[model samples]
Target chain A: MSENTRLRPGDTIGILGGGQLGRMLAQSAASLGLKAHVFCPDPNSPAFDVCAAFTVAPYEDLDALDRFAESVSVVTYEFENVPGATAAHLDAKLPVRPGVRALEVSQDRLFEKRFLSGAGVAIADFAEIDSQAGLDAALASFGGQGVLKTRRFGYDGKGQIMIRKPEDAANAFQAIGAVPAVLEALVPFDCEVSVIVGRDLDGSSASYDIARNHHENHILKTSTVPADVSDATTRSASAMAEKIVAGLDYVGVMGVEMFLLRDGDEEKLLVNEIAPRVHNSGHWTQDACLTSQFDQHIRAVAGWPLGATERHSDAVMENLIGADVDGWQSVLKEPQARLHLYGKAETREGRKMGHVNRISTRTA
Target chain B: MSENTRLRPGDTIGILGGGQLGRMLAQSAASLGLKAHVFCPDPNSPAFDVCAAFTVAPYEDLDALDRFAESVSVVTYEFENVPGATAAHLDAKLPVRPGVRALEVSQDRLFEKRFLSGAGVAIADFAEIDSQAGLDAALASFGGQGVLKTRRFGYDGKGQIMIRKPEDAANAFQAIGAVPAVLEALVPFDCEVSVIVGRDLDGSSASYDIARNHHENHILKTSTVPADVSDATTRSASAMAEKIVAGLDYVGVMGVEMFLLRDGDEEKLLVNEIAPRVHNSGHWTQDACLTSQFDQHIRAVAGWPLGATERHSDAVMENLIGADVDGWQSVLKEPQARLHLYGKAETREGRKMGHVNRISTRTA
Candidate 1:
């Protein structure tokens, strides 16, 4: 897309997913006086409740995609797993930010690792494993301890198993349905952190403060801003993220998950993964900063200038998973807590229902 | 309505009037996981671009009103002039927050003044004027200096005439089309200010910081939070707002516009008018407070607990009238400014296109 592709007010942004992220992207689009048209197969998608328009059809349906594209000026997705064909189809029709290349690379683990390595960013050592013998050989090279992950469609610790010893590898390939996979030498880190960065259509970039993340059952539980990492580590992580976005010629906000490893008296950072859309860890920006990650993403994709990434207050964002949302009443009563509920009808276990961002005055 | 009228996440809120206020209210409802259905006669209503559902029919259309009411759990209005009959029509089918009484009282200046006086809120001296003789007689009593205004449908300096001298009354009656009016003694005010207060279904109330206002061409130009008033005056203003809401048994956010008059070593506040819905002055809350006026209004109308009213930053909110919105690009580049545009298809002179909230750290 050309640098002159700025969207005017009242223009509709076509979003390719209809989940909470899509719901939030729609809200952010509305704040800027822009409209949102969500496209998702789920008729009951949470985002359908807040968007100006929606197309409920499978991503593979080209006719439906054409109709959706015809109604919008630009397209963006809320999930990185948008089918390559879907992205390619829309890319041919209109501008799709972060582009198809980001999708193609992040969709597979092996490709993601190679991309990070090629961009000169530090990452865990990994090897593509298409067979049981391949996994064993990679494990032997990594000293018998590594994480086996599917090359595609894996999220929240799904489609993977840990091989700590010879016995632990039994039926490991079968456990993940024998899908094409990658085995990576696990890096022992002090804590996991992530950086949310936004790249505008003009190649300018901005990043938010690093957030220290904690997980439960492999799902993100909480993200606290002003991460416990040293200033050098924060700079290193931000530089890595900028490099990756620049390397991909990416536009819009990207969340780069990283591991902060302690090396004696120094700190080392490793790129864990890259999310080419707004991530859960950046939700704190909604209440603590002038421009939220969602808003920044919309701005970038619309060819507008990126908003300030400076957060006025420190915050801790906690996701409301499944039954945990039952405590919404109490969350509402908390003085510093801002509750954001995704309009989901059902509360199945492990489902992400909503989130709360607790903010406080910034501390030096 | 009962105190148990709390709306669930997926419940829809029926909003009367699809202007900018309704648009922001719809966005706030979405944030809380509630759906918004906007009802308005204008098919191009700005709120339509943000709401889940919409009805393009006159407010007086009972058939459309009935159908619109049927699809929502609760109803609320964005404008005070929601025709008592239309409010009564919806109130009969479901709970209409702020209630019909607020609409009845606020729709007519005569009723509003009388209600304020009856509620023991300090207000300017005024007398109803139904005829030329009455206008002349009332003008004589106010030291030949008062504002002659239509008792209904007057806003932003419209439908008002100043009678400063004997000659000023020549075509004054004919100027306003000789409608039923109110003649009020003009008081020398130090400045204009407003307070936004929210009262829940259970009768509990909370108020945001007072905002000092400035007007240009009779339209609100700016509202600066932490109004330049004594501590006692702020307390007095908030107390007056709470008293008025309690008197009306109001549920939802109410904006009480007041004139701050300076006396010997004292600050006196008089109720100028009451907006039974969220007010433009409260737009500052969107960027500075945890719970914005729109969010508080939705929470109250939905019968949910009110969020905190404390502002994390000091803010100055300025309305973008007509061509002022053309400066949105510059506003977007400002690090501390948050731009909000009403999705208006056309920009006409005197139209309220949007607003910008500029914030800074609070200082004691």
Candidate 2:
């Protein structure tokens, strides 16, 4: 890819995925006087409603990709699973920030771990399990409970199996369909947290406040600012995110999920995974901060200077999954809640429909 | 209109007018999971881009109006200029919150003054100017310079003219096309300010902090919250807003513009005008307060309880004119400027293209 970067307001931002993340990114871009051109396979994608233009086509359709490139100044994805060939197609034309290297590492669990380890970042104990025997050996090494996950395309608890004991190793491997996977020892952490970091084309970077997150059935439920972790832990988590961005020369909002582990007398953060796009946990920034993560992503990809990630108030963002959004009116009555509903036609079970952020002044 | 207000999340909101207010309102409604269907005469309206459904027919089109009413659960307007017949049509078919009373009282300057006076609200010295002679007579009665304003369809500085001197009255009258207008005595004031108040269907009301405003060429240039007015002035202004809401039985966000005039040893506020729907001056609430005017609007029309109107911090919202949005990158870098762009297809001279809100914690 060429090292040339050019973007500006009024320019169109081409997004690869059309989910809630894409919807918010488009909303943010519109707020900046920039137009978003969403490209996704789902015709019912929520992002289409907020964007100025869109094309619903398979990611591998080179003709559609070309048209999308012609319509936008820069390209970014809302999800990491954007096919490599698709990114390559757009990169060959206009600039694709958070480049292909970042995608390569984030798309696969094994590659992400290797890259983090190489950067001297702390992560969970793990080993690549490409075969059944390899899985067994890895499971034996971890002793007790370990999770065997497919190396690629796994998200929100998909493509993983838990090995509760040595006796269950074979069944666990079989449960994962015997695919190439990575074995990670179960992490005993105090809490799950994430830090959203942004990088510009010029290598500048900034991180938002650490968010303590809770998940139900592997999907994010609520994210609260000023995670119950110590200030030093936040610093370490942000440092890890910055190091990852610098290592990958990444641009745009990248979410680094970490586990706050208590190691005897001290507490440390362990890098669990890296998401190369805006994460759901950062949604509170839309109401609590000066610039939202979506706008930050658009700015970074467009080669604009990174915005300040300082938050103005304490906030909690909760996702309205499936039928939870049905009570939108009651939530709106909360006086302090700022509601966001994605314009999706169908609210099937387990689907993320919208979110609400309740903001309040931080107590000293 | 039946009091059968059971609007849920998946409900459709029919919005009248397709200007930037409608566009932003639609965006906010969608964020809360509600779909917006915009009805306007202009086919290329900016609001069309972000809405799930749109009708490009004149407000007088009964067939279109019937279809629009059948499609959405509730109806509201973005501008105060909703034709009497248009509001009547929607009111007969479905619930139109901030109903015909608001439209009837606000669409014309004469009616607004009469209504406010009847409601026991204080206003400036004014009289109807049906002819050029009427303008001269009002000037003679008021003593010095006054204002000549068209009674209907006037906004910003469009249909209003300042009579700086006795000799300028006829010229100012002629400048405004000598329409059926109002002549008012200009009251000397310290500054102009406004309060944005929201009322639910059940009559519960909430008012945002008074915002001190600045106008250039009769157009709102900027608005700052925790207005530089005294505490007493703020209370009076807010009470005035609440009074209008109760009197009109208004549901949704209404902007009440007032003037702070100094008396002997005290400052008093005089109501200048009433906007039946969301007003430009209240745009700062989106970033500086717990509930934004747009989201609050959606709540009101959806039969939801009004959100809190608490100010989160001291804030300044600045409008971006034709070329003002060009420096969005610099604005984004400010760490405090929160940008909001109206997705207009074209930016013409003196057009309100977008706005940015800069928020900071205020020292008590």
Candidate 3:
């Protein structure tokens, strides 16, 4: 799709990998007079609850993919781990956004790191490790302080292990089931921050305010906006995001996770990871900004002009993890809190149940 | 529900009436992480495409009502025309928001006028006409310039007739099937405006920016925000809205249609009617305000604190009547325009197909 030929209201948008992100994306699309048709394997996926149409078939099914492509004008995915063949299958029939380049970079950790570094962006020190010998040599060169992570299908602190000593490498490899991996020097940082940025097909890019994120048991717990970062640092972060988007020729929202490193007199930044789709940290935008990340993503993918990224108020977004949702009534009673609950059938420990976004003119 | 017992994310909300309004409400509820179970007689209602669950049965089906009430935490309706017994049926089992009082007042034109007048809100000159003689007397008082509208089941110019001359009263009454009706003196207003106001259980109310409406063939064509009215007139319009809400002890968003009449040097406002649910004129809020009417309705009925009522920018909302939806793709190309499409299966003339909300910093 060209930037001039944007999808309008009543146009069908096909979303891949139906989940909460897809659910929110569909809702945003609906609010703007667009229809979303979710295509995913799970028949009970939460995204289907809000979308106008859905296809219950695995991503690998060519017939299902064809039917999904034919049903909507444009297509985008919620998750990056979709098999390369699956994306290729959908792309052949329709416009698949965030493009193949973003998917390729995000699917493999080593490739993602190389891409970031090649774009002249700051990232953690890393070394590729394909076998036991390669891991041993990388560990010896690094003074035995690094993390070994699988190259694919890893998220939320999974498929990785810390290595403090030489003997720990074997168990770490075994922990990841001896999958193809990379070893990188762990950066000791003060806090984690993520920038959710969107790039339209017309090359117009916009970024939301960076967020100071806190996580518990590898799951996001809270995100405070206005990120406690200096105005100069925030500008630099936004510039870095723009560089990444321009480099990838990216379309739609992408999350760039960074570490705020305090080195003596100055605060430095190091890229940690990149998410090809909307990030959990940017959830605050729904309540705090004029246009939300979900809406931005849909607009970018549909080849439409981007909305203003200006925020309306200071915000604090808190995730409702498992029993955290039990006190939903109390949270709702908080006069300025905007609560969002995913209609998940079963809520298990560490699962993302829902979230509350409290907006206040009162700022810290 | 009490103020402290406001609903949070992951709660279930029951919606009565499975039409476009219900579909939009269900989409908003889902965005807030709440599940919606829709109850309507038509199995093929468009809203069923998005809701978590739905029951297809007559409004008076006690068994279905019981099951619906048992499944949802709160019950709200999309239209005011819900049978009085049906609202009572759900109200007896669960909390029905906007309450039966608001529904009763809006369901009948005569009751709406009485309620507005009793609340000290300005209303058009009107009289209840249960017989032909009553209509003749009302017409005589109006000097034969009046409108005869059915007390019940009237919307979008249906069940209404204009009496231009004394001799036309009989045919005008016959046009409405001679049902119980109300005859009102037709005010030569400069413009039509509406205030979409929300009232929480705590008696707190919030009103959206007033919209100046234009109608063609008795069908709403467009609603422009930042209505060209004096500040005093705007204040009175909003105050009248608050009074109406307080009178009904309402707990959801309601649309108050008003006439902008210029009498000598002063502009006066008159309450035309009350829509006890989200109105098409309020569709612009989805893109132009901090909180949308559907979201505000969900928030209010769920006993949550209302969101900010701030309008983002000056906006114009245009309804895509009939085959105008065929040009949806072209409309999407406008950067400032936000399109919203109802998931109706077919497009019929005079039907509310969808709407586009165009927000710009510059006023038209």
Please give the distance, in angstroms, between residue B75's alpha carbon in candidate 3 and its true position after superposition.
Answer: 3.5
TM accuracy, model 2: 0.95
Q: Rank all candidate structures by their TM-score, best first, as comma-separated numbers.
A: 1, 2, 3
**How far is A49's C-alpha from truth in model 3 (Å)?**
1.6
**Better model by TM-score: candidate 1 vs candidate 2:** 1
Better of 2 and 3 by DockQ: 2
**Residue-level lDDT for A325 in candidate 2:** 77
lDDT of 2 by residue, B1-364 (tens): 6355657766899999999899889888877777889999998787887777899999999999999999999998999888889899889989997788898888889999988988888999899988877787788889857888899989887898888887787567678987889988899998899999998878888889999899987889999987877888878887888889999888889999998888775988889999989999999998877778998888888888888878767899999988887776678778777777776767787899889888885522
**Leading candidate by DockQ:** 1
Among the numbered candidates, top TM-score falls to 1
The digit string of per-residue lDDT tens for model 2 on A214-294 reads: 999899999999787778888898899999999998888999999888877588889999999999999998888877898
Q: Please state the Cα-based DockQ of model 1 relative to the true two-chain complex.
A: 0.66
lDDT of 1 by residue, A7-111 (tens): 998899999999999999998998898999999999999898778899999999999999998999999999999999999888888888878999999999999
Model 2 docking category? medium
